[model samples]
Target chain A: MATKILIVDDSKLARMSVSKLLTSLRPDWTRFEAASADEAIILTGREHPDVILLDFNMPGTSGLELAAQLRQSHPHIPVAVISANIQVEIVERAQEAGATFLAKPLTSPALAAFLDEAQARLSVTRPSVR
Target chain B: MNEFLEQFLIESRELIAQATDDLLALEHAPKDAARLDSAFRAFHTLKGAAGIMDFDAMGLVTHATEDVLSTLRAGDRAVTPKLVNNCLACLDQITAWLVAMEESEALPEEADADAAGLIARLIPSPRPEQPAPVPAANPGEPTLPAHAAAILQEQIEVLALPQDEGTPGRTAAAMRVMQNIFTRFGLSAPAAPTEPATEDTARPQRMDMARIETLVNLAGELIVVKNAYGHAVSLAPSPALTKLQAQLDRLTADMLRGVLAARVLPLRHVFQRFPRLVREMAASLDKPVRLVTEGDATEADKRIVETLFEPLLHVLRNAVDHGIEPPGQRAAAGKPSPAIIRLSAARQSDEVVIEIADDGRGIDPAAIRATAAKRNLATPEALAAMPEPELLELIFAPGFSTAGAVTNISGRGVGMDAVRAAITQLGGRVTLHSTLGTGTTIRFHLPFTIMLTRVLTVEAGGQAFGIPFEAVVETQQFNRKDIAAFGAAEAIIWRGKTVPLISLAATLNLPDTPPAGIIHTVIVEHGGEWGAIRVDRFGDQLELMLKPLDGLLSGMQGIAGTALLGDGRVLIVLELNEVLK
Candidate 1:
């Protein structure tokens, strides 16, 4: 199976910029976007994306809350919480929820490291797909 | 130049306008919570978009403004006109920065100073009870985190406020406190602005008017070629050829309609900008006026809507400048104190009628007559003989103005003439109507669409011409004996009415046909003027794409545009109104 990614951010520009960067880096990867956490959850269920990049501050069901829900439902899938506001509380909370915290605006090197880590984590946990 | 960045710029521009409008609305209904939330959201969205593109200056300004809006929403701060003005100024600055960014892929050099200035102005005038002193960072070290750095810089600028010169700053200390709290929680520093991989970035594309025009033109060419092919194959028609032709015809017609539909846009795109304009004009002129627009959702061809902005703006300026009375004068005249300017657009059959009406002292024919005579536009007797409507029409005459003094806005006498010329250039006509004390209405009748026109082709003077079907009332075959010479012109009796008949060949300076035989005449009407132009013969009516004449032939009075005929000949579409004039 090809690598599938989902980005959930209320800002359209953030979604587009991140998608462009990801596609350029991993040419074979498929990308999807959702503008809200509710939509993000629904798309994740339907697409079963391998990984998710979620924004921290949203109108409702913020990234931290959604991260906990996804961790409970799909432990094998990695969720990277992308945020502009990164406090220790959020970072520890996200970590406790079995998700990683990534700072934005996303740069090339940081994104590569995150993806490499995600790939290793995914490959180790899932036996059905390499 | 990347698609994401380009989209960010475009979306930011729109959000700035939306924020400004909502801020202004909130100024009126200060307690409207929903409107307040909407205004705050616009700023928040703008800040997020700017952050994505790493537009630090824009992001900082919007962030500060968002904070103020949030305070208002939380009922911690009052919504004052000063606050609204501050918000509007921030929107204006963002708009300018966006424009600069569009031109050069970065913000302007003075962006920092402008943001600092606006941030300084955004600080509440009244001081909070107790201020927290900011912890000084070590010299030559960057102590603040990235996100806090932007806010810290703004707060440092706030330290220079004249009234708060000796006061300790809460903003910087607040940022420090937040950063320390985050550090205590064991979180890493905030992310720096991302530098994506160096690749060629294509701009995000939208369906703008120029691209639509190209599509429309291509569709038109397809039609012309299809028509030519049909004509060629008709001589030796077969079942296969007929079937192919029918399919091609349906495909091309569908393509043309689809392209034309894509070019339709609601008038609100143009109408929305005017509320801001009217508000500014009201403030500058100190004249209380209300602008009411109707039928804003009416749609028109994209090209027409784009070209209408200037002409509509000119007429509207004229209404505010010359038509509307001052508040004092209006009250004395027993009219409403704040004058009303109503701009309404409606689709009337195949034409769009736009009316700019104002409730004020109407145009005086005697004043126009005096101006016309003084400007040498007409002789004294001629001016007297000119009826009230015709006298008012003099306002459109070049270099004619009845104003005794020239002001900043409209009195240089150059407005209405240009308005009429522009409308006429688009193959439309404009007229004026005014009662002594009621008001003045300037009406423009424009073609519903400029791309394709239905016209009747006529052959005169050994050349073919296309007459718009809308102008052609009827066609008659008259014997030469029925035509009578009247002074320098000729006339014919048709349906108990005497219509002026002029030989098309003579008028066009073409080879004269023999007058001894039957004459073909096509009657045309343009703005209450009816006449018949004699032609040699008539051809089939066609829906043709009108391509305006170019270069030196562009302004030749009677030629509207050129169209390609199926036989590879060019047909001149006549400006029948101009010809009649």
Candidate 2:
């Protein structure tokens, strides 16, 4: 089964670019996009994606807030919060919300490392039947 | 261009336009929260876009602007004109980079330098209550000292060794050892796995200008051949040939129209830059002035649009420097305190008319005459005999300036003559009109395109060359007796004025035959001075497309470009300014 990933950002261009990067890094993984935190939350409930990528800056319900909310309900999924403005306080908040902090202009290696870790955890907890 | 970059350019340009509009609106009503929020969102999105492209320098600039805007949004800092101007400057830099990326499909080489300068300017003053924002640090990588790394390696190696059943606690013991090492080195262990450094393998494909130029040249050559074919058919006067020729003419005309349309761009690309510039200039000069632009949507060839900035900048500087009087002087004169400088462009039948008008002190013809006489640019009798309009034209004379003291703004050796020369090189004409106290207007009449050039071919030393027809004032045959020697130089009298003369053959260091009786000369004007060039004979005038020299002959002085003639010969065109220099 292919792993499903959700990409969320306020800007459509940003979402598209991130989706492209993710596809190049993991060709077999499935990707979904949302333009806001609300849409992302709705999609998460519907798709049950294994991993989530969120943009920190948005008009309503910022990425960190949504990350905290999702952490409460879905404790098993892995989350990464991305932003161009990476202040120390923001990093601390992301950690407090049980999410990983990634810098913007996300390189392939960075996304690949996160996905690799998620894949290992998934394999150990929910092994596929042969 | 790749699809990704094409999309980038299109989206970034829209963002820039939106940001510029919001900023301009905010300048008028600084307290408008809606505009402020809109502007902030624009910058934030632009920053995100820059980040997605891995344009680090562009990211740095937009990030700085975003921080400043956020501070304003938080009500911590009040909106100021300086802040607005700085933001606009940042957008201008981004726009410049976008243009470069569109042309080359790669990051600009000067991005770092531009970013550093702009970031310095964008740095906001520190508030006593809030500390300055710290520079971002990479959180993923936790570097270790060489000795500490060695110690960790030793522990890992020890753990890897084979052990008996009694040494089952070896893994736990090695973990304790690593904790001790971390404590001693004053470093915290990484919270997550570290990623190895990876090279970026994605390189955007670039569009080649040389290929495009070759295609354009081929198209021009085809047109020339088609014209020749028509001529041949005309000579024979065949009905079938005439029908074929008419069909060919229609197809060629359509192709030419398509090509020319692709090269046309709106004037806004150049006009949008003046608002920020005028603001800075007004602030520096301590004058209350406003800039009003009209007909920015008018279109012109891309070459004309790109080459217009410098000359227009000089003209605007002059208008702000000498044309506009001080606020106190304006108040005393009962005119509006904030003087207006209007920049307008309109398309004429086959030309574009651009005018920069200033509603301030106009040119005083008497002052110009007095200055001309004092500078010895002309005799007192000549200055007295000249009309007012002719006297006003004296400002364009080289080394002729009426400013009492030189200011850094306008009069540092570059005069109106340079502006005229630049315009003339583009097959354009510039004229100045002024009323005593009402206003002054500088108008430029420019061609719609730059591909075709009308050249007057001349032969010197048995080799033919081309001179731009616009630069040639007139041609005359002077008797050898009339040519007088002046200190190893030759001079000729033309229209009751003594003009210096130089032999083109001698200047070019070519073998020449000495003249016997009369010298065939062409009088050319450069930088407002008339000089005669002696040649063997003048050839037929022709309109041809000029191709700039490339590869080996690139940057060659005194030669502008090469044009192909009808008989398969190459005509070398001269850059008159450099040649005369």
Candidate 3:
């Protein structure tokens, strides 16, 4: 089965750029987009994407809070928090939630590395499916 | 332009508008935390967008602005007029950059200098009592511990192989490696958690104005085709054909209404910018004035809403510079300080009525009379005999200025006359009412829409043309002897008044066949004056979707636009006002 990825950001341009880069790196991966934490939560439940990429700073709820929540409910799924200027506190909190931190503008190499790790984890955790 | 760049420009403009609104509101209520937060978010998002686009200068400037906003948000700095002005100025620069980017479809060159200047202004100066704080490390570089770093490297290799079964064993294997790494640092592992979700699937698509305009044009063409169909059915009338024609007429009317409504926009688009303008103007003129707008939600055709800004700006300038009295004078006149300029709009019947009322020294009829005489606009006896209302009307005459000395704001020769001319061109009328000591009110009575025009077709010099029905007062036939020649001009008596009579064919330089006995004349009104146009014959009345001439004939005077007649012929519509002038 092909892997699925969910991208969340308030800025449509940012979301589009990430999707475009992800497509170039992993053309077989299916991509789902959300513009807010609330939307991301709903999409995660419905799409069951294998990996999730989120923006750190949003209007109502920060991505850190959402990442923490998603980690509790879907521990097997890998999540990455992406932001332009990643502060130390945000990175620590992301780590505590077992989520990866990636700096933006997201280059292909960093995203590919994360995807490689995510794929490895999925294969080990879901060997029956494989 | 590429999609990302186009989206950036659109989103940047929206953020700028949002930030401007918040900043302007903050000027009135400095303690409004919500507005401050909103403004901060807009700047933060703009900064992030700039960073994504690799616009280093814009990112740097917005970052500086965000720092100041953060200080304000933290309650460390108080909002001040200078702060608001600097923010607004920064937004103005960003607006300029966005415009350049839109034109060039690339990052603006030479933005570094402008961004540096704006950043300098955005960074507030430290007070003498407080010392400048040390700069922190760049947030982009976060320091990580060795063990935590090991997990990032170890996880890649630990999860590299696929297991056939024993999912629990594999999970334990991954956790055991993390546990062993944590044991080396004498630390514990963290646990994870999740939740339920609600669904919302309301997604609205945004349509650009050009696409909407294309739809409007198509709707207009459909109207023309429907009219042609109706005409064809009329030539050979049958019960069935008549029924089909009626059905087609109703459907076309409904679609046209919908299309035109799509072209209608709220007057708020034009009115929202006035409060800030009035604030700046009041500060500069040293006159305390408040701009209060009402009925901003009233909608009008997009063209009307857009074009209204210029004429309204002229009126507002006049109201601020000449209409509103200074604070001292206002108090001496037993009026409250900070004079009010009210801009209100409403839809009445088929017209949109906009009124700009100012509470200040109104136009003095005697002063207007003196100015008219001084400027030699009329004879002294004529000025003296003019009614008070007629004397006040002199303020709108060309080159008329009642200001004792020229002011930079309103008295550089473009006066109320220009305002009147602009309104007139938009198929609107401007009327002014002023009470000597009380105040002045200017009202604009404008048409609902300019799309579908009702024209009366006429044949002149063997060519068919259209005259806007609103301009035609009445048409009549008179004997050639009734026209009396005065030197090079001719005059005719109509309704007990002498109106100018001109041959339309001759005016247009077309071949003219003089009337042998009786001549067909169309009496027209333009700018409160009357004129009669002579035509070869009068034709049918038509409701046409008038398209303004473009390219070579864009600015051609006396021709308003072209329209298609029901019988598949092109009709040239005349701008009677321009023709008469």
Candidate 4:
């Protein structure tokens, strides 16, 4: 019952090194960080979770207006972004808004192929918020 | 998460000792509205507890230390000491990545993207880190020791035992207080102590303050080799080189100020988080406070008791948000609906006072002379001829609030200009007083160590400055026809007071010219005004070393940092809070 995950950054050491690399890939994910995009829209208004990572530049707000305010108030919170300023129209604007990209100094096999294709596109859509 | 990363490394070491006593109380009282509201609530509670402990490299280095403490909390930049030692080395690299994740169970989070590329070089977008030959080191050990060799070059490994089964009563009460500090330092306590992650590198190697500043530079090079063996025993030399340089400079400056008084600490780590911030600001304002504290063992200088803990937690959260009271207005002002405060600490002369006080509803000086007569900042006949300690020092100005509203845990005034720029960058001074319904101290003082001062020695445009001794106030030798000419500017008039002059070639834009006549001045002062300056001479008083003004002439103005003197040269000092702006 873990997979919570959010991890946006403004870096407290890259959010404690991707929260100690997802707590060392332990009891499977829980992390969280949002220092801006008004705290990932107040942490997806306190719930919308199951994968986010994000970070594309911070300061006032901008993770692409927090991925268009999490695609209009949490479009089933997908996001992945992550960055080290890798451009290509920022992965073609996070693949034209439908999120999921990685390019950063981030390792662990590019965060395990972004949690294996965002857990097969969240088990075909929302799958109980993973 | 390891008790929220040990309460966010004891609240980012009390917001890096409230940004090093608000950059040493804004270097002796700069535009202090209570040290820029305690460096904007210690970088807004260390960027809101490093964004609720995900620690994104200490929440993007405290969100660029809350945009340089909200640009010195809206007075738009001034609190310097190199931006309080680069937000105290980004709270010593988030306390060396929380003591490398409490001694490695692993979490140097691979030095969190090289500590967010050294906190995006303190904020100036277009990212990258190449500039490591200087500035806050650690890019690849450019002279490391900061975070003491990044927490003694991390290799720690001990996170395996405590599954919390009475964690062996917290590792046998931290091994009986490290065997009572190793048998009170004489060492002998290892009788039967062998198991619990014992030899994985004892890195918290205590004896701190940079090992008591290398035993105060080997007790000042053994009192300069006992004053060069009392000048070679007044030339009568050989009493075996004057009793071996007076017994090796009296047992090395009494064993280096007795092991630098074991890195003096006490003031209970500066009153350990003010009784949990006065029981969470008197149970979130239903009021009924208490607090107390007093000297809490009163020692000093472990970097000034870790920077008088967040400017005495924003003077006990402005004595529980605007001096206590609440519970039915302290029983309709007859008092006792619950309030107390106090807080204390001692040591004076070469400083460390502290205070805090409170009781309830005190400060009012007509709500700081009607918020400095509604921000025109005094004029209703100068707020009716000011004085009541200048109307309780206009409740430390800035955006002075009496707090009828706006507050999450402190009125909107912003913790008295960060407790007067963290006790004026620690050469210190805060003062307040109050009194109305009666009760409110404030105080502060500081200098147990921003590390030495005194200064004076002059010279001006042909360089060499230093100044300091509380910005001087007297220097003399004028008459190049009493220095007048006010077009390209340069006034003087001295005694009956006329002041505003500049000269070391119009304050260092330099081209030379002073030696052609007999003109000297110096003056300095600040709160009331006095500049005089015009130098070209006066050099006697010595003691230098302050440093901090480099990132290549920090965009020069009237210089305020650079010191190396003990007969070497490089002196430059002046920044009396950017020459009182």
Best by lDDT: 3
Model 3: lDDT of residue B29: 88
lDDT by residue (B100-177, candidate 1, tens digit) is 566567655546656765776687458633234344376644344344445546645644556542232222222333
Per residue, candidate 1 scores C-alpha lDDT tens digits across A40-124 of 9899999999989888777668888999999988878888898764579888988988888887677778788888889888888
**Against the true structure, candidate 3 has what lDDT?**
0.79
What DockQ does predicted model 4 obtain?
0.03
Ten residues in a row with the worst lDDT in model 1 chain B?
A: B193-202
Worst 10 residues of 4 chain B by lDDT: B195-204
Model 1 bad stretches (over 4 Å): A21-29, A35-45, A50-130, B76-85, B124-205, B208-214, B230-250, B344-355, B376-392, B401-405, B431-438, B443-445, B484-486, B511-514
- Runs in model 4 deviating more than 4 A are A1-130, B1-100, B104-276, B279-311, B314-329, B334-425, B438-454, B458-470, B476-543, B547-581
lDDT of each: 0.75, 0.76, 0.79, 0.62
**What's the chain B TM-score of candidate 4?**
0.31
Model 4: per-residue lDDT, tens digit, B1-581?
46556545555655565555554456446687667666655665565555554456666666677676666667777765455545645654554555556655334554554455446546646743343422433454234223322322332222235455534433433343333333322344443222222111112223255767787666655544454556557568776877776687567656655665666777765464455445545665667676766777777667667666666776787788777877787787688755788788888866778788887778777776766777676687978887788777766665665444666666545547666765666567687777788788888776665544557877766667777877787888777777677787767788887887766555456666765567786788854457877778887664443655678876575565666554445677766655644
* Model 2 per-residue lDDT tens digits across residues B200-235: 000111224345545666768877787578658767
Winning model by TM-score: 1
Question: Clash pairs of candidate 1?
Answer: none
Q: Report per-candidate DockQ.
A: 0.34, 0.30, 0.39, 0.03
Between 1 and 2, whose lDDT is larger? 2
Docking class of 2: acceptable
Order the candidates by lDDT, highest first — what do you get? Answer: 3, 2, 1, 4
Candidate 2: which stretches are off by over 4 Å?
A1-16, A25-130, B1-25, B29-38, B53-64, B67-78, B85-214, B227-250, B402-404, B454-543, B547-562, B570-581
The true-versus-predicted C-alpha distance at residue B404 of model 2, in Å, is 5.6
Q: Return the TM-score for each candidate structure.
A: 0.76, 0.58, 0.74, 0.30
